[model samples]
Target chain A: MKINFPHRQFAHCESGVTANLLNYHGFPCSEAMAFGIGGGLFFAYVPFVKINFLPLTTYRIGPGSIFAKATRRLGIKVIKKKFGSPESAENELDRLLEAGRPVGAQTGVFWLPFFPPAYRFHFNGHNLVVIGKEGSDYLISDPIFEETVRCPAADLRKARFAKGALAPKGRIYYIEKMPVHFNLPKAIESGIRDVCRVMLKVPLPLLGVRGIRLLARQLAKWPDRFGEKQSLLHLGHVIRMQEEIGTGGAGFRFIYAAFLQEAAGVLENDRLIDLSRRCTAVGDLWRDFALLASRVCKGRAVGQDSFDHLAALLSSCAVHEEALFEDLRSALVR
Target chain B: MKKNDVPQHSGLLSGNREVNYAVDVDGRYILESSVGWEAKNIALRQAWEAIADELTVVLAEIKDGKKSALAYHMVKNQMDPALLSQYSGVARWRIKRHLKPAVFAGLRPADVVPYAELFGISVDELRFVPEELISPLAGLDQVEADNS
Candidate 1:
């Protein structure tokens, strides 16, 4: 069974999946718009949580939130399910495909056979669309890749049911209803408000702008506390999360900047234009920090690249992000 | 970032292009495609180097008969006993015991099927290990992150 769904490749997964599903339902959402409306951008340096045996330093919020939040904000209705059994999940997915509805699935990447060797890891947060099935292979529209691919039924089952942190648990979702029209300005404003509020005012030192500053303070003493080699390893891990793991570089700051520009046009607020530029500047600072930290990771000698210097760069990002979010909060307050 | 400053490095994401928001000549934001970035590549290489170092130690232990081939395979997959046990449906204590060559050698075919299937290898090939140390993780002809 196959349906004629036009698939567009995107830089990130959940937002792309949201955009594609909404467009298919005739809602006509762009990826950046979906990301912005969903409040997709976030930062947290949770040192206690472990991924790949290192601290989890996520560039974005937890997986699956973008789709759920974006759909909610746009006033679209979706049916989502997580099945306890692989058999039931496969049956439901096959029924949906036979009914000619394209379904979005949350899957573990490690068991997905179509991924290139380098991209295969134990990450369970990857999102893709099951557009159709031919014989036993399911058609996949993975946003990160340039084109659609295919995975066999058994492998798809394994991916859907893979065990680990953030396991997908045979999850599937599809749009159930599309509104005639949405209050675009309202949605945009609400998204901007939520992001600004969380980034600036969250009480936990581990959560928001406070999190970045906390990371900065702790990073300076990592070499003394954890020793040089371990500190470099953590530095390298943070750099990868900041630069490599699907953030469009600089930790999605540029993406949010682009969103702010579009939000300005939609909301007819010129102040957002200035905030957009400042956000872009903050993104540049993060790129600078990542570049310096990568150097620090490479310069393994005890004091070759001063951890203090790297910490200073990170502190500047925290400083600028605090200012940018403060301005955004005030911009929305009026 | 400006459109010109995006680094098109040949690294981990070789042959695959990702979208970046860059400012064009008009200073308007446009989605630009990038092959890779140097800092990301370094970070990736750094991670794979640490993995490679761990695998090297595991391989030496495997050769010295202090550890079993399961130990080498586990390290290659970046799994410790707890993680391997989760995936393979083996108990943690049993996994630790199986990491010894003497215990692994006496195990029956049925006892190893879970692991062999978990790693997507045949029971016999689960014992396979590369002869030498490996390089960075991005791209390589010899150690291409494949268990097939």
Candidate 2:
């Protein structure tokens, strides 16, 4: 049995899955729209929280927030369940498939057999939609893939139940109700305000723009503290978090820029178009930082000057982002 | 990024390579597969090499009886004790205790099942460090072959 769900490949997994599922349910949500409404853009450079033993440097909000926030703002009803046992989770997922409801699930990338071996890692928090089940294979709509794919039942189960940080624990979610109408402008305003607050007003020195500055300070000291090879590894990890891990492009700045462009149309506001362009420019700056950092990582450059240059780039990014979000907030407020 | 700036294909020879972003003719962003970006590929290789280095140190520690094989697998799987506890249905304290080489050596088969399953290896394999754990670049050769 299959639901004939349309699969659209997207840059980021959670927002893409949210948009696809919402569109499938007749809400016509685009990936950018879902991302914007969900307040997906964020920055945090937490030194204490370790990912793969390095400081956690995330470019966006945590997983599952986009889906939850977008659904809530749009007045969509959804059922979310996490199972304690694999058996109950599989049984329930099968039951949902039999009833023709496409389900969104959180899974670990490492356990999914369809993934290229190089892409498989211990990092969890991958999101996918299960559209069908045919005997032993489960039809999967993983957002990051270029096309929909299939997974064996055993692989699917293991992925869903994969152990480790951010484990899915057999989590499954699906829409139970769809709102007939929602206030696009209000939601957009709310989303903009939320992002502005996070970027500009978050009190923590380890989060928001402050966190970026903190990262810059710490990053500049890496060579002195950890030596050349280890410092390069640290730099490489930052790039990986920005470019390779689930970020659509330019550490999600491009995606959020796309969202702002769409918002300009939805709210019929000209200022947002200007902000969108600025956001794209910010994305370019992030790309520049990545390029430079990549050079350092590859051993093409070594010196205090190179590290200082990278740290300067991050500081500039933080300043630009702070100003951009402030402008967005003011534009929405008026 | 502009449509013109998007690389049509990746040039990476090893590691997990894919380009998840591109641009359409109209300059709209699109999702596309890429072999890998050159700089990113280099950085990823270095990152993996760093992990391999960490694993090497971890394996030596386990072999020297300073820590359990669990510590070796933990680093190999990129996990910490907190995360392992969450997956293994074991308490953090107990998991920490199990990290001692003495306690780990004394653990029965049943006690090791959850961890063995979590790492997708047999209990016997879990008890001893796998050969792949010795070199962090265990699978990159195959990736290079596939790319070639």
Candidate 3:
């Protein structure tokens, strides 16, 4: 019989094994048997031997971005400073697995419908695990695990949830592989890919930039019904305006430019909707404000770095657009 | 164990011993050979390509007129076509039909102004706008500002 040890900070595979064995039959989360069994396993282990799935200890959450996503994965990759290409992440995964540690990572990338449309813009926090793999399918363990799953690495890269930010950024951890003789044979599967991603249900009006961006263009005008705190309401309108152009997907620039004309007028109103037609340039509102604020005030402020980072990403996107158009025009001529 | 000495199940199969022995050997051979599988994923890429092209044509038709502005809600995203149509004013059939094609063809149908309106901006200005920036959100410069 396998010897059982007391729970410790770092759990060994033996402990995990015993936990799995005793809990395997059918153990409830809050039961005395469950706690005594699982917690006892957690407490009596030495460092580097025990593997614990503690949410706060390993994972982190923050703003999402193309560059940040790449940097996060860099934390675990061997022999690399920058997680440069998709191929590089693959190489990193291979190296890590061959070395016997199973890694968990979250990419800013996301799938559409993972959240309501209002929560789509720049909202972060997605967790996923790299549960080894075979062939074209990467075995994954997600929080909403219903069954063990295998998905094409390429498809995972392309998921909208990755939000085009396809590298680990949110959360990360790893478990060292057991000795060969004692290693557990992988079972048929344990979890499903139908992830139950957590969604924070906040009031619609309280939702920041994205909410406002949608309302401005879709509503024809921002609603005055919310009333008072017009600047806050105006801020909501501005966010809606931004959403029209934010890095949503291809062919969105034209929509942003067109709607900017309408959203600006909304900003100038008593309720920010009456003069919605006259507003032609929405960038005028923040570009000067941002530049002047940066020059005048030398302190860090909330949304300051976010504003700059997003602006830079947006600019890069613009340059990419120019290149595509040039290529298209040249193609047409040829 | 050697080629001709099997006797345990032969008593049960006395009526047809030769056939049962042949069947057991064949089943074992098949089970061993099936340990690995052949790759057949070409079908998936082909399906995507066919679906994408058809979708682009459908999207072009849907955003042909006034509804072109609401194209963002209707095209390329993973949302249900019917859901998008509720907001986009284009019919759901058009969205389902055209979405993949628009994405595959490198067109953002949701951001595209009607072909008639494309002439409003100078070709140079059109050149200035990124295809990506053509979404209903960012395509309109003024709107992006407010949202930012």
Question: Which one wins on DockQ?
Answer: 1
Docking class of 3: incorrect
Tell me the interface RMSD of model 1, in angstroms.
1.6
Ranking by TM-score: 1, 2, 3
Model 3 C-alpha lDDT per residue in residues A192-304, reported as the tens digit of each score: 00000100112333122222232223222212332322222233223322211121111112212222222223222122121111111222232333232232122233233
Candidates, DockQ: 0.61, 0.45, 0.01
Shift of residue A149 alpha carbon in model 2, Å: 2.2
Residue lDDT tens for model 1, A198-272: 787878888678888888888988988888778888988898778774677688898889889889888888999
lDDT of 2 by residue, B79-127 (tens): 7888788778888999999899999989999999999988889999888
Chain A TM-score per model, please list them. 0.95, 0.97, 0.29
Model 3 chain A — which ten-residue stretch has the worst lDDT?
A: A187-196
Regions of model 1 farther than 4 Å from truth: A300-305, B133-148
Show model 2 residue runs off by greater than 4 Å.
Answer: B8-33, B61-72, B90-107, B128-138
Ten contiguous residues with the weakest lDDT in model 1 chain A: A296-305
What digit string (tens of lDDT, one per residue) describes model 1 on residues B1-148? Answer: 9999887876566457788877788767887788778788777777778888898898899889999899988887778898888778899999999999999999998998999988888999886777886543535433322321
| Runs in model 3 lying further than 4 Å from the true structure | A1-82, A108-124, A159-161, A164-334, B1-74, B78-148
TM-score, structure 1 vs. true: 0.94
